[model samples]
Target: MDVIVSRSGGLAGLWVTWHVHVDEQPDRDDWYLLIRELPWEEPLPVPPEPDRYTYRIRCEPHEATLAERQLTGPWRTLVDRVQERSEPERGRPANGSDRTRPPSSRRPRRGC
Candidate 1:
């Protein structure tokens, strides 16, 4: 299974994404356990507060969006683990550069 987590709407208003392939993880079983315990069917919380981060999580067919204030317990655990173990999504580096791709392969700009 594949897991994706994205955080947006923080003070910087930047979108940061992380992705993990569960089958590639050494602790896949532990991830499965945490995933199974999430309240997927429960209603999502109210709209996020201004300038607060919002998280969107997806594990295959199951997905949820939660405000920063609502991330807790198992949800927090899963997100933290994924962020620690996974790579940044393509073209959405937390910094200004694309960490997934090599610097040599980047195209040069047409104009200065």
Candidate 2:
């Protein structure tokens, strides 16, 4: 299985990170990390149009591993970790209306 996560607000300048693991050697193209940084403007796209400076980490599995039992999952784990480290709750609240454009070609819901 795979997971994805996004983090926004809180610290003035902070970076988001994620780690993913699969049952076996899966196609690299099947999964990836996408980062979209919100610009200082109105009507920001859901994904911020894949900001050139956005932060993301793509997971690559080891070459020799096989018959895997556990997977690293998705960035959600990292986001949860960040939340635990930063605030008392699960990071900041997501205001979807703040965005003007809908989610980009990317899949899944967009949160801020």
Candidate 3:
């Protein structure tokens, strides 16, 4: 299962994104259950704030958004951890950075 989270807007108007591969994660079942438990079928509960952050979550056949104040328990937990993993830790790359991007192709240079 692939979970992609996009967090947009903040004090700085920055947008952050997260992509979590549930299968590769340690608590795959928990993640799956959490995702299923989220209220995806409902419409945006309230009108959005002009500059507040909103989240766009997409995974498999499920997709939804938690905008501004709508960031509740499970959704909050999910995004928090995803962001934590996104921050630079130690001298290495961000935790989930490796799985986020695909490999690029390289061609041989012409003979000089």
Q: Which candidate achieves the best lDDT against the true structure?
A: 1
Q: Summarize candidate 3's per-residue lDDT along 13-85 as a digit string, tens digits.
A: 4446666666767877887788778777873754557668767766657777777688888888877766655
The predicted structure with the larger TM-score, 1 or 3, is 1
Each model's lDDT comes to 0.71, 0.28, 0.60
Q: Output the better candidate (2/3) by TM-score.
A: 3
Tens-digit lDDT string for candidate 1 (47-83): 7488787787877678788888889989999999989
lDDT of prediction 1? 0.71
Query: Which regions of candidate 3 are displaced past 4 Å?
Result: 43-46, 87-112
**How does candidate 3 score on lDDT?**
0.60
- Stretches of model 2 off by over 4 angstroms after superposition: 24-112
True lDDT of residue 99, candidate 2: 22
Q: What's model 1's TM-score?
A: 0.76
Give the alpha carbon lDDT tens digit for every residue of 1-112 in model 2.
3232233322332323233332222542333222122111222233332322232322222111111111133333433443343322122223433322212223332221
Which candidate tops TM-score?
A: 1
User: What TM-score against the true fold does each predicted structure earn?
Assistant: 0.76, 0.21, 0.67
lDDT of 1 at 65: 86
Pairs clashing within candidate 2: 21-72
Q: Worst lDDT window (10 residues) for model 2? A: 62-71
